[model samples]
Target chain A: MDIFRRNNVTVAGNPQGPTVVLAHGFGCDQNMWRLTVPALADAYRLVLFDYVGCGRSDLTAFSEERYASLEGYARDVVEVCEALDLRDATFVGHSVSSMVGVLAAETAPERIGSLVMVAPSPRYVDDEGYHGGFSAQDIDELLASLDSNYLGWSAAMAPVIMGHPDRPELGEELKNSFCATDPDMARVFARTTFLSDTRDDLGRVKVPTLVLECVQDVIAPREVGAFVHQAIPGSSLVTLDTTGHCPHLSAPEATNEAIRDFLAGLPR
Target chain B: MIHTDQQPEPYESQNEGAPDIQSHRDSTPDAAFAALLEDSAEELYEAAPCGYLSTLMDGTIAKINATLLDWLGLERDAVLGRMRFADLLTVGGKLYHETHFAPLLRMQGDISGIAMELRCANGDRMPVLVSSVVKYGESGEPLLIRTTLFDARDRRAYEEELLRGRKAAEEARRQAEADRARLQDALTVLQKSLLPDTLPTIPGVETAAHYHIASPDRLGGDFYDVFPLDGERFAFFLGDVCGKGPQAAAVTSLTRYTLRAAALHDADPASALATLNTVLHDRYTGSGDPRYCTAIFGILTPGASPGRLTIQLASGGHPPAVVLRADGTAAFLPTPGGLLVGVLPDAHFATAETVLTPGDTLLLYTDGLTEARTGADRTSLYGDEALLAFAADHAGKSTVDVIGALTDLLASFGDGLDDDTALLALGVPPLTAQP
Candidate 1:
């Protein structure tokens, strides 16, 4: 149960400087941070890792009962910190992983110095007083779409070039550079991410936090980000002019700059 | 090439700087045939079976085939420069396209067979299968995305049929699971009916019992009961039927009632077991899947003095009972030469007589306690010797204490306890019974 091997932990950049952990969302791995990592590479230590049952992390370590809720995912984050002996680290989480960071910070408050949530939604299903932009039936349809399309995704996205059998290292490079995930793991992760409700966990944050809301995101709307900001005390909120849920991929420069500005303003 | 005066000009080839090998270079038949082939290239592109289109890296449609434009019911000029490929998709499909498909295509260089529905110009929706590849330049930069679209009308109909079949199968499976759960609940209730809801409280004797079911899905044959026979005597029996399910449950009920009837008739443990053996042998002879049982029947009566009790216990091919004394001593009350009941016409049963003094406990359990598999190998059993040692270690314990410790021992076995266990313990208190 080595956490580094369990989560495919990768450490880069200035090791002596402040640590920034980048966590990917439901459908992707740590490679999603490729565009944003370089923006902070000169000033901070970059820590990247995939959750269990995603990317190159050990598939044998997955247990359905253990991952039925986001708390189990938070346990993984805490275990990673414990394994690396990281303290006062900044956590950058995208989509569902943002709530995962909130839960992790609640668990070990002294270990995390701050949090940055990008395009986050505390609840995806619509409730009585809140509009999360998705219905239960919509979520069910999304799960069905995943079921019908998983095989196609697996065969087409195996990270191996179609005509390059002679150079195996090229395939290895593609595997490391892209989001290569097992189909079954991806389905379970989608269920765990979209079906989770952790809005109550947001109010427990005592550290300095930043909420980055994309102006036109389909997955997490602007109001949801504003709700997160209002729930967590003394948290700063910034609205990005990006048009997609993935600002890191679609608008990396703006996303990175917003993060940099937020980090620079924090009292280290 | 025979290019007649009626044909329009050949459409321009999109590839730049290509050799004009298909043109009429010479007047030979080979050259003329090549020119003829070149003349129909635009015709093929316009009326091809599949729809083809090219888009810029930012998803703007740079070119499109005539077949795709015909399907959308739109003019050529309206779509050529006005729409992104994602704009053609439905709202949900567009979301999925942006979130998963676009990112994958950008990173992986190719993606295929993505299911999506396209919103046509006339406000009608059409289901389509799309496959796209990124064309790279000499410098390894992405130039354009070439996508081929297949009309999925027949395919969608077939998929709807398949979806209906799959949903039916899923409903049937869910129904079967719910049926299995309800049957398990009924069996559990029937099994519980055979045991006393609460052990009858004897003024001088303290009694406790525990039943360990290996699985809730199947009924276990283990049964135990403590019921009074008369003013001064109580009858108790603990046994295990050979198999599980309703048949074993029936046997368990028969054996329990038969033991009570025989004990009430003769008020002797040995004669009661003999009657049960005769009844079971008579009922199961010449039957399909013959059933049998191992039992230990006992009669309890208060002695002449307080804090004293005498018991006569009989075993029919069952494990011997254990006695943990008040002075920290433990031993098994051996009942030897007992044959399995309902197996033979003249099966023998043996009786053991023991006294329960102050602070002494007597334990009766089925073979599940001794024959439980131990450790990871699953072949080594927690044998009778281990049970004897366990009894010795927990000596001078009350009835509840003994039962609780045995329950913990059963739990420690985890998945190794493959059979159900029945435990009954009776003790005489050192002090006043309720003080």
Candidate 2:
């Protein structure tokens, strides 16, 4: 019941530059965008809000049966955008957040401008015709891990998301906004987002798209980024020469350069 | 294999055969041996197979073992002197322990073997069955509470299986209820589809019919319909199909439609039954599962002048119909013999003719009313004699009065009557009023 307890926490960037909505992955919060936000703050109006039951959002607003679906998170993106009156804003999504943006854009077509898909994956399960990585049984094993050892799975999953935990700052940054989520909600979302098959909706994105791939990312690899590109017609793909899934945190300068170049090429 | 901490004999007893060992060893070897014993105690605590720890009187963790530390991926500096016992539980575990576990332990002196969870340093939670005992020093002073924990992976899987089984059972129950409702709706639709919503009013006839559905939860097997074939002639039928539920309901639908269609082709009631018998026998021939039913059909021919009806009655393996005489006398019209519908390819239905004068009434009823078994001698069914007796007492009454009596009689049976009942009554009302 206490999970629905939430307060507004938004970080606004620049008005002169383009607006960018930053969405963090499953574990971390709005703070995970620290490196990327600094570089784009002057050039883009950055708006960030926590998914309810994660980060600073209300915990009581979370329901196991309702929040158990990624449809809630996708709806949250739409509501937050409408609540803030964000129009034609660029969507910067990481990991599963990239698919959330796609759904948000599909829900309200006019609210989106261009999508900067960073390490996006439509599904974590492999099917007969599609290879989204991992199998349905493999995902079951991951769910078992959470049910058996929630903390162990959460901590184990952190390094896999952050890539290299030996760098204390990156590890510590992820640790800051983690416990802010209801573990039950996280478990449901983990199963849903990673297990979903959204191959049908990729053709519906009306806006321009840019797929960003990490050259050495173990979680969302270059092959996945290429797959996303193949699904979306006329979409451009760029593989960054970074080693982690979270390149903005590890190699910000190169990441910033790629994003800035893509934004400059837009039809002003 | 490692006996590093075995207790030794007393120093004075050992020194009896040796030098003044107490003086020589008191400063060096004895002190070293004491330190070795202490170190061994620490090693045993750290390397125990099951997790063991000591909590302060206030519940702060004073010491923990390496077995648990390794499970949590936590070094000693992180937990040994820092976090409290409650800090190791997940958010839900913490809430449960505070609301349930802590109160129980405080009142009970010790609570043992309770299933709980410990959140590891790496954010993974370990399910464990925990036991705790509080130690008191001399003079009844509370010292420290020692706790032990065992892994519960296999137990968690078993619990999940039970939860799934319960969930599946509940879903199955809900589905069965839904299926029952769906069958009832289909029966109602089929029943209405066959019968006329309103009965036809002949020139001199006050017709009233009632269909009592004993059970709306399952499909009823009774049916009745009244239709005008043409000019001054009208046709009416009331029947009961054997059995109940979806299968019987299906046959009822087919039988009702066949009777209507065949009557349109020929006014001969025998020909109509012949058509229905062929349809049912042919459709269900190969399968040894045969369906049968009882029915009474009548064609009412109005008088050429007025105020009368020449009614032709045809009954199939059904009960004898009652005709209350116009002059306050009730009697049964002779319908010789008829075969049950669908028993033979050429089933015969006997025909009879009766003239309904001004106040004569014709009553048609299924076996549910006459065959209702009740009383201390439940072996006796409500036969035709009882129905005729009941009708004789209510003679000269309007059709509604007789129908109301029959309806009350149906309600009186309660659970004794199992089959569906349908009754149709046509009485010529004194030729004064018209509906």
Candidate 3:
């Protein structure tokens, strides 16, 4: 199989500079990095891709049994790295992808050298002593909400979502195509994202890690951010003063500056 | 009543133009009513039927209409400048708004017809459809956001009903497929029971048999068996019952057991077939659904001389058996005068006898082989002449080789071979020199 085409991998930016792979989280595809790409393109070699079952990636390659856990997504990441023969590259993941990057790093230690977790959370449901800011019932309600919005992702809404006749410069492939996904695949992805627990894997991070959290993210609260920081002994944490879960889109300037500084500090 | 009250006014003012009546009404109660009909734009904004709101780029509500405030049961003071649009949604709706709704709106200038639920003041959920647009400033920068909400209670309930109906239909289709698979499995097990798992090894002879079924869904009526009749003799039979399905299968099962029992009582081939004929005619002749079958029964007895065997066989409305000689020649042992068994009280069974020298074989089969269709148009039958020629081609070969070649010939017919076929071959092994 052509791994690059299967994952819809895209390579951009300075070819001679260090590589940085941008991995988007659930509910969106590689387009989530649209705003952040421009800020880092001048100094880094950027790799962006949509996981299987998301964006324009091949839907036929998606297997429910394989993707039911986080390992399947990590395998996609590792394969992309091997396809390009990347070495010592930095992996930047958002939301649930932060844990996926950690797993990829563990599987192929040579391909990914450092990590940058954006709005990261190892767990979303609350435990007895730890507060991840959600109850088990809340995740179920989220799945229900995904079911209710099935019409938005259906073919009836495709023409409206893909129609951008006024913006002819956006090209045929990129015209207004933003978070359109198959409803059934999205349901599987949603279940995998909200139900997974990767808190135990945080202690094994052996690379240079940067944990970027938003100031008022309801999905990943400040307490969860602190737990992630303390779990990784030498990891650094930076909190962006934003209101939503996506700091890169909400506060792009601060998010870019933090990422650039972390990359510069890494060993050559 | 109003028409009757004003009926005489137009006629009384015919001398004047229509404008004179309009001017005269300026001084009457009609003028006051017209004044009341015209309202300012402010009243329309506050009293529209649907909910409306405008927010900043970051979702801070800057303005809200009275209709939306009434739906939320909140005062204007409590909402404006104090809440974002995400605050009014339930937890699921809030997550949806943050993940899918917000990203989509930012990418496209506007988004419409999104279904969601809002939390009212008393904790009741209200289903609504929302549409939003981003207003751009003079510098092409995004400014405030404008939104409208429509109550979708009735529509949501109907959609739920459709989803339920679709689920039920899918479940029923799955159940039907499972039932068909289970029934096919049962039919396969029952079909296996009608034949021997393996033929017994005769002391001084070699035997090979093959049975072919045209369709797995329907049980075929073809059957064959080879078993010992006594210490010095072996009995074999091959047949096809008339028609197909359960009734034919019942007849096939009965015929096999009756022939076996009669052959044990008397090793003569003709007597064994006559007893089977009597049993079948007595059991089925008087019934309205009379049944019958075509069969060839035979016995093999070792001759007094070494490297030789005696064969005695009888046929009841069955095709002739072929004999292949050691000198590479083949001929049919015809039994032409036989009547179909179970058709009459006293049926005439034709009898034939032959000697099998070393390297000689006897082949018996059902009509499914000779009646198979051939040619490009599939209109020609593979008759006795072609089978005799085929046997001639494989003369002097062992029983296994001859049977294997015939099995290949049957397979070559493909869809043209529609009926069940059974083949049984018995041969005396070729003599080998002493070491």
Summarize candidate 3's per-residue lDDT along B1-435 as a digit string, tens digits: 001111222223444444644555667677666454433344445677778888887788988888888888889888899998988988888877877787777767677888888889988888889998877765656676778898888988887777677558768888988988997888787778778899999867888988889888888898888899878889999888998888888888899999999999986877888888898888888788899988899988999987689999999989999999878899999999998888888889999999998889999988889999999889999999999999999988888989999999999998889999999999987775212
Residue B323, model 3: Cα distance from true site in angstroms: 4.8
Judged by TM-score, which candidate is best?
3
Q: Write the per-residue lDDT of candidate 2 for residues A1-268, one digit (tens) a residue.
A: 2211232346577877777888876655666676688788887788876777666676557667766666778888888777767788888887778888898899887787888888788876767776665666655645454444333324444443333537555554332233334456667766776677776788888788888887765456567788889989888888887654566654568878888888878887
Q: What's the DockQ for every one of the candidates?
A: 0.16, 0.02, 0.49
Residue B422 CA error for candidate 3 (Å)?
Answer: 4.4
| Model 1: how far residue B166 lies from native, Å | 5.0
Q: Rank the candidates by lDDT, best first.
A: 3, 1, 2
Q: Which CAPRI quality tier does the interface of model 2 achieve? A: incorrect
Off by over 4 Å in 1: A1-11, A21-27, A47-247, A250-268, B1-44, B137-139, B159-218, B226-232, B240-243, B261-266, B270-296, B301-435
> Tens-digit lDDT track for model 1 on B116-214?
777788888787888888877656666677788899878877776776786688799999999998998898788798888999999889899999988
Candidate ranking under TM-score, highest first, comes to 3, 1, 2
lDDT of 1 by residue, A5-104 (tens): 7888999878787989999887767878887888998989999988987776766788777777898888888998888888999999998999999999
- B1-435, model 2: which lDDT tens digit per residue? 001221232222333533443445556756867555444444556676778777775556877788988877778788876876667765445433432344334334465555667788777878777776666655545466677787776776676686567658869999998997887777778767756788877667778887777777677788888888898788888888889878888888898888889889987777777787788888776777789888888888888767688888788888878998767789988777888888887777888889887778899989888888877666678888989999998777778888998888888877767667888988777654444
lDDT (0 to 1) per candidate? 0.81, 0.72, 0.84
